[model samples]
Target: MARTATHSPARVDGPPAGPIEIDVRTRVFTWITDRVGVIAISRMSAEDLARARSRRLSHNVVTSRVFGPMPEDVSLTDLRIAGPDGPLTLRLYRPHGPLPAGRHPDEGLPVVVNFHGGGGSLGNLDQSDWLCAHVAARVGALVVSVDYRLAPEHPYPAARDDGYAALCWAVRHAEALGGRADRVAVMGDSAGGNLAAVVCLLAREAGPVIDAQVLLYPVVDLTFDAPSTTAFERGPMLTRADMDVFRTNYLGEGGDASDPFCSPLRAPDHRDLPPALVITAMVDPLHDDGVAYAERLRDAGVPTRHSDHARAVHGFICFPGVCRAAGEALAEICEELAARLA
Candidate 1:
C-alpha cells in the first residue's frame, strides 16, 4: 500500500484525513501472500475450492477476538426454524435481567433478524455471535442470526427464501423471543446485505412490516456495472475476479443475474420498502451499488440513509480489530437502529 495506493496503476481509496497505522505484524504474512499470487478459482477443482474457501472463511469469521468480548448482560441461544430448503439454524441474542419498570417479556422489544456475509456460503451463527450479542445488549433489542443455505449448493432464492422466512418467523414469534413484532428489521453484511436488500424488496409486495433495514457493504448489482466495480476491481478484499467466482457459485450455472432477488438494483419498484441504512466502505467495489440503490430508493419515495466509511475497507464491519473505523461504523449501526426502532 502506497498513499492512495496505486496497485499496478489502480488507484485505491485513500485513507481519510487521520492516522494510518499499517499492521507491521502482518507484513511478513503479506509478503508471503504476495509471492503466492492470487487464488485462481478458475483453475481449481470443486473440491479444492471448497477446502480453500472453508479455510479462508474459518480464518476470517468474526469472533470476540476481533470484536472484543460481548457484554455480560447478553445471552445467546442456538435454535432451529423452518427454512425453505429444510430446517434452518439460528442464534438468538437477548439481554438478561431487569427491563424497564413497566416492560414485560410478552410486551417484547425491537428485533433484528441478522444474516452473515461470506458470499452466503462461508458464514455461520458462531462467527457472527459477537455482533448479534452487541446489538442485543447495546440496543436493548432481541437479535436473531440466521444460518442460511450457501452457494454452489442451495443456490439463489434458497438463501433469499431462508432470509425472508427468518424475518417472518422473527416477527411471528417476536413475543416468545422477547422481540416486538411491530418493530423489526432485517440486517446483513456483504452478501448477507444483498439478502437483506432483496428480502426488503420481497417484503414490499405483501409481507410483515419491516421497521428498518441495515445493509453493511451490500452487493446490490449482480451485473457488476457500477463505477466502484471497476474502481475497486482489485479490491484489497473483494476483487473483481473473486466476485466473478462468488457470483457464479452463488447463482449456479445458467442462473439469471438480472433477477431483482439477485440484484436489488435491478428492481423496477423500490417504493414502500422500509427505511434503509446503507453503509459502505469507500474502498469496497460495492460502494457505488449502495449509492445508486440509495438514490433510486429516494426517487421511489423510500427513506434511505447512506454512510460511507472513507477509511474502512470491505468487510470492515466484521474485522473491527483490523480497523478503528470499523468500530465507529458498527457504533453508527447501533445508534441508527436504536433511533429508528424507538
Candidate 2:
C-alpha cells in the first residue's frame, strides 16, 4: 500500500475578503465567449443540447488554445471497458521516454484515474486531454481519463457508477497500463470532482485503495445552499441558473439531492478516505462546496489541502491560457500527486 501522509489542518490560501477580482485575461475571454453565446446550457433546448454535445467544445481549436495543447511527451490511446450501465470509453495517457536506469518499464509508476467536468451532462475525454497528458508526463504516472455516460438520458447514478467502475478498472489493470497498482489517485473538476470524491468514499468501504484525490472547483453539495452559491449566483462562467439546469437534468424527476453518493458533502462520515487537494475559484458559486468538503475531510483526520484562487472563475483550470491561476494550480496539483503517489 502507498504510505498515507499525516493529517494536516485544513488551511486555505488566497486573498482576504473583498470584491472578487477576476483576471484581466479571463475577463476578456469571457467577454468574447459571452458575445458569441458559446454555451448557455441553461437556456438551451433539448435539440440544442444534443448539438452542443456533438460539437465537443473541448476539442475545438479555440478550446485547444485555452486549455493548452496536449504535452508532446505524452502518448494517448482510446479503449473500451465494461461500465455498470454499458460499455464505456476511456482514454489512456502514457509518458514518452525510456524507463530510468535499472528500473523496469512497469515498475514504480503511479496511476491517475480522471473524470472530466461537465455537470454530469456536457463533457468528454477530449476535454481532459491537456490535463491527463500533462499529468502522465509530469508525474510519471499512467493517466486514465473516463468518458462517462451523461445525464437526462442516463440520469443519476449513471455517471457516478461509471466513475467508480473506471477507478476499479484502472487499479485492476495498473500493471498492464505500466503503473503500480498500489499507487493510485482519482482526480476531476466541477461535477467530475463530485464523482472523484464519491469514488473515494466508495473505495473506502469496498476495495481498491486510492492514495489521493484532486478536486478542482468541485460541486460536492447539490443542495445549492452554500453561501458562495448565492454570492456568485450570476457567475462569469458557471451561474446558479446553469446549476439548476444541471441539477434538473442530472437528477431527473425524483432523484434525491441528499444522497451521499450524489452529494459526498452530505456523507454520514468522511473518515478513512484518501488524502485530498481541493481547489476552489473565488468567482465561482460552488466555491463554498470545495471549502466545506475540505473542512469535512480535515476534521475527519484525512490529510487535506484547500487552495482558493482569487483570480479564477469556475472551470478556470480548463482555460489555462487565459487564466494565470490555472498554471499555478496545475503546479500545485502535479506536486501534490507526485508526493502522494511516490
Candidate 3:
C-alpha cells in the first residue's frame, strides 16, 4: 500500500533572520524570466492584463514540462459542477493501480480538494496538474483541483464560496468519486492557500469536517505588512507590487482586509480548525504570512507543522523541475496529509 509521511506536530517558527541564499537553479530561472519582461500585474496596462488573462486559460506546454512530468499512474478528468454563481470546472485525478488487499475500490481512498495558486487572479486547473496528480498517485488519494472563479471579474466570496461549495460537493459525492467522505483534506498554494485556509475556517463553523490543510507559501495576511513583505519586497518570483495587484483584484473597493476570511492570520480564534502543514519559502515576500499563521494555529491548540525552505523563492512548489526544495515540500505535504487522513 502506498503510504505518506506521518502527521507529527513539528514547530518551526519561521526562517532564520538573515539573507536567504536562493538555490542556484531558482536564481537562474528568475533571472531569465525577469529579463524576458515578465510583467507583474501591478505594472500591467489594460492590454497587458487582457493578454495575461487570455493566456491563463491553458498551461504553457514548455512550462508544464519544467514543472516536472505528470505521474503516469494518475488519470485526469474534468467535470463541471454547480458553483455558488454558476457552473465550476474541477479537474479530478485518480491513481490507477491494484487495490490493497481486502479494501474495496470505492471506500479506501482519501480525498484532497486542491486550489491552484495565481494570487486569485491568474491560473487554471491545468497549472495544478503537476501537484495534484502527484499527490493522488503517491498519497493514494483522489485529488480534485478547483477552477474557482477568478478576481477582477468574480471577486471575494465568489472564489471563497466556490471553494466551500466544492468541498461540500466532494463530501456529498465522495463514494461515487472513489473516495472516503470522512477522509477529506484541503490543499493549495499562494492565493489558493488563502482559499484553503479560509475554507477550513468556514468548515469549522459549517460542516464537512476537513481532516488536514496543506498551505504552500500562503498569503495568510493581506494587509501586506509582514516583515518578509518589506524584507523581500522585490522578490525573485513574487514582489510586493505584485501583491498589491492581487489584493486589489481580489478585494475590489471597500473590501475588508482585516476580515479573517481575507486574512486567515487575523482570525480571532484559530482554536478548532483542522491539522495544518504550512510550508514557507525564505526568499519570498509572503514568508512571514505563512509563518505567523502557523504560529497562530499552533498557539490556538491546533496541530500545526511548519517547514521553511531556506533556499527557495516564492511559488517554488510549482516548479519542482528547477526548485530542488519543491520535491521536498511535496513529500512533506503528502506525508502530513497521509498521517492526518489515515
Candidate 4:
C-alpha cells in the first residue's frame, strides 16, 4: 500500500484593505502593482529600473525586500545558461525552510519551469516571487523562473527560442539542480503563458516534449477578438491598448501573427501535445484566447482542463498573497501535475 502523509496547511497573514477578498491574502499587493502600471519604455531605458525599484520599495515591500515576508523559509539563486540564441538567465526558487538538512521533504524534486507575465515585457522573477515560493513549498518542486529576453530588443521567435532553450537546459541539468528531468513541467501567466504554450507546441514538433504545461490567463492568440477583450477593454490590470503596444514591440514589423509559434491558438494541430491545465481570469482581456485554445485542444483530442477565475484580472497567478484566486489556481495546477507525473 502507498502510504500518504499529511502536512499542515499554509496560512497567510495581514491582508490589504479592499472590499474584495482575493485568494489567501489582502488587497495590499494589488494596490501596489496597480500603481506601478507599466512604466514608459523611455524611462526604463533612460534609467535602469531605478525608478521601478523605488516604487517597489514604497508599497511593494513584501516582494521587493528579499528575506522579508518570504513564505516560512526558501532557497533562491540566480542561474545563467546557454540558450538557442545566447545566454539565458533565470531565478531558481526552492522551498527548503524549517526542515533540517537531510529532513527536507523534496531534497530531490521535480521542477516547474516558469515564465513571468508582462505581455513580453515588464516582469521578472522578482515580481512573481510570492507565487514561486508558494509553488515550491506546496508542490514540493524546485521552481525555475526563466528570465527570457524581453521584447523590442528580442522579439517573436527570440522569446520562444529562449524559452525552449531554458527548457532544454532545465532537463539536461535537472539532476544537478536536484530535480528530475522526466518530471519537468512548463508554466506561465499571460504573455509568459503564451510562451509556455508555444514551447509545448515546438517541443512536440521537435521531440523532447515536456511532461505537462500550466497556462494562467494566457494570451494564446495574437488577434484581439475575444469577448473578454471588450469586457475588460478599459480600466483593469491589463488593457487592450497596453496589449497592442506589447504585440507591436514583441512581433515587430514583418512578424507573422498567425504563425503557430507566435500564436499557439492558431496551431495546425494540438494532438499528441502533453496534457494541459489552462486557467483564465474572468475579467482578463486574454480570457477568450485561453478558452478558445482549450476548446481546440479538446477538438484535437488532447487532454485539457479549462478554468476561469471569476472576478479576477490578467496575470493574477503571481499575486499569491493578495489574490486568493491566484493561490487556488496555482494549487490546482500543482496538484494536477503531481498526480499526472507521479
Candidate 5:
C-alpha cells in the first residue's frame, strides 16, 4: 500500500477580518526556510535539486511521522494501471469502520481521489501516505491517492490528463475498490490543488461526475502576480521564485498561462462545478488563489466553504508533528470531506 500527506504567519480567512496577522512561530520557521533557501538550495541547479530531493525523500518516508504505519483500523495497498505514459501508480487507503457486513472495498465505500502538491513535478505516492491514512481513518472513506506525471517534461496537460484518468479509473472501478462511484470527490494541495479543480472542470465533458472538490492552497492562477503573491514574495516555504520555478516547470516556455486547464481561476465559468472547500493560509503567496476561486465559486452559485488557518503558513499539512495548527487543520479538512461526502 502507498501513503500520503503550511506555513503561515497569517490567516487566509478571506473576509470578516482585517489585515494579515502573522504567527510568530510560523514567521520563525519561514524565516529559517528563507535563510536556508538563500544559503543553499536556491543556488543549486535543477538537476542537483532533483538529486537532493530524491535523497531527502529516501529519508522522509522513513523518518516522517506522517509516513509512519497506518492506524490499526486502516489498511493500505499500492497498485498500478495503464496510462497514456507507461504505468501509473495509485496508493489506496481503506478503513475498517462501519461498513455493512456484505460490503468491502471490492464492494464500495465513499472514495476520495487525491492528487498531491509538488508543483506538478516533485510529488510521488509515498509523499502523500500520511494524509491518505489520516483521511481514511478519520473519514472512513476510501482514499485513493494518484501519482500523476510530473512537469518540465510532461508539461501542462500531462498531469491534468493523468488526473482525469485516475478519476475515471476510480469511478469505473469503484465497486471493486469497495468505493461508491457516485460519492467520489477530488482533493489536492498546491499543484495538486490546481489539478483537483481542473479535473472537475474537465469532468464536465468526461463521463464520471465528481462529487466535490477540496483545494488546499492551490495554484489556481499560474500568473503568480496576485497581490498575495507579491506580499508573500519571500515565503515560509513557498517564495515568489519558488512559484516561478513551479510555474515555469509546469508550463515550460510560452504556454498559455490563461488557459483554464492550467489556471482554474482564469476559467471563464465556475458555474456548474461541484461544491468546494477552499483552504488557505494567510502567509502563503498562493493564499489568494484559494480565496479568489472561492469567491467566484460562490458568485457562480456553487456551494462553497472557505477557511483560513490563522497564524499559519503554506504546507502546514505536512508538519502536524511540529505545528499544532497543522494537526488541527488536517483533522478539520478531513472532517469536512467526510461530512460533504456523506
Candidate 6:
C-alpha cells in the first residue's frame, strides 16, 4: 500500500516531549515519522489521519491481545441481564471476594456499565475481562460489562441500541445484580467509549438518567478531523489505518458519521448528560476527541472532570495489569463516580 506524509501546519500543544520510536516493522509508522516528523500527527487534519489509518489496517491485524491475564484476585461471573428488548447477556465482575450472599447486596455496591472498544468492530467481554475485574474491585462497584453487538455484521446503531438496552437493563436490575440502579454509571474505551458517551446523550434525551460517565480515550467526534489523529497516525497498539477500517466497518452503507449517536461531539447539546469523568492519553489519535467532548460537556452545564495521562497512549486503560496508569486511571474513575453516587 502507498503511504502519504505531510508536515503539521499547527503549533505543538501536548504533553512534554518524549522519545519517538518508529515501528519499521510497520513501515507506515516509520514512513509517517520520517517524512512528517512526529509532531505532525497532533497537528494534521482528520482526513489525512483517516487516509493514513486506512494504510495501517491493510498491514496490521487488529486483535484482542493483552499484556498478561487480568488480576486473578477479582472474581467474575457471567449472566444474562434482561433488556427492554429481550435478554442481553452481561459479564458481572465483583471486586470483593466470594459473595457473602450469592449476590451483592442492594444498597452499597455501585454498578459500572462497561462497553469494550475496538472501533466498534472487534472487542468482547473476554477481552475486557481484566479491566472490568479491576474496575469492579478497585471501585467497589459491580462491574457489568456488556457484550454489545459488533460492527460489519451489527453496524452503526445496532451496537449503540444494544448498549442503551444493556444500560437500561442494568439500571432496572441493579438491585438484583447486587448494586443500586440509582447509582449506575456508564463507561467504555475507544469505540465503546464512543458508545458510552452516546449513551449519556441518549439517556438525557429519554430520562433513563445515569449518575456518571467514565470515558477512557473515547472517540467523541466523527466529523471534525482533530490534529491528534494526524500526529499519532501510526504507532504501537492503535493505528490510524486501523481507525479507517473501524470507521468503514462501523458506518457501513447509508450510515451518517455526523450523527451524534455515531459522534457525540456533533451533538448540538451536551447539557443534561450525567456528570462525566473523561480520561485521555497524551499521544493517542483520539486524544483530542476526548478533550473536546469534555469541554463541550462542561460548557453545557454538565459536571465534567478530565484527566490526561501524559505518558500513556490510546487504550492504555485496558492494560491494567501491565500499565500502572491503567489501574490508577480506573481508580480515578471509581473515585469520581463513587463520590457522586455516595
Q: Using TM-score as the measure, name the better of candidate 1 and candidate 6.
A: 1
lDDT score for candidate 5 against the true structure:
0.75
How well does each candidate superpose onto the true structure, as a TM-score? 0.84, 0.92, 0.91, 0.81, 0.86, 0.77
- lDDT per residue for candidate 5 within 29-118, as digits (tens), equals 567756666313345587766764464333254456533344667787989998777889898998886653344545557899999887
What do the candidate models score in CA lDDT, each in turn? 0.74, 0.83, 0.83, 0.70, 0.75, 0.70
lDDT of 1: 0.74
Model 3 Cα shift for residue 43 (angstroms) = 2.5
Model 3: worst 10 consecutive residues (lDDT sum):
1-10
Q: Model 6, 40-76: lDDT tens per residue?
A: 3333356654453343211112322323355556777
Task: Candidate 2: give its CA RMSD in angstroms.
Answer: 4.1
Candidate 2, 233-285: lDDT as tens digits = 87788778889989988999899999989999899999999999988887888
* Winner of 4 and 5 under TM-score: 5
Looking at model 6, the pairs that clash are 41-230, 41-231, 42-231, 53-240, 53-241, 54-241, 95-137
Which digits, one per residue and each the tens of the lDDT, describe model 3 over residues 241-288? Answer: 888989989998889999999998898889999999988887888887
- Candidate 1 RMSD computed on C-alpha atoms after optimal superposition onto the true structure: 5.7
Backbone clashes counted, model 4: 5
State in Å the error of residue 205, model 6: 1.7
- Candidate 4 TM-score to native: 0.81
Model 4 over residues 121-240: C-alpha lDDT tens digits? 667667667767767876777889988887777777788888888888888888898888888788888888888888898788785658888887788878777666776675356777
Please state the error at residue 335 of candidate 2 in Å.
Answer: 0.4
lDDT over C-alpha atoms for residue 54 of model 2 = 81
Q: How many clashing pairs per prediction, in order? A: 0, 0, 1, 5, 27, 7
What overall lDDT, based on C-alpha atoms, would model 3 receive against the true structure? 0.83
What C-alpha RMSD separates each model from the true structure?
5.7, 4.1, 3.7, 7.9, 5.4, 9.1
> What's the CA error at residue 281 for candidate 4, in Å?
0.7
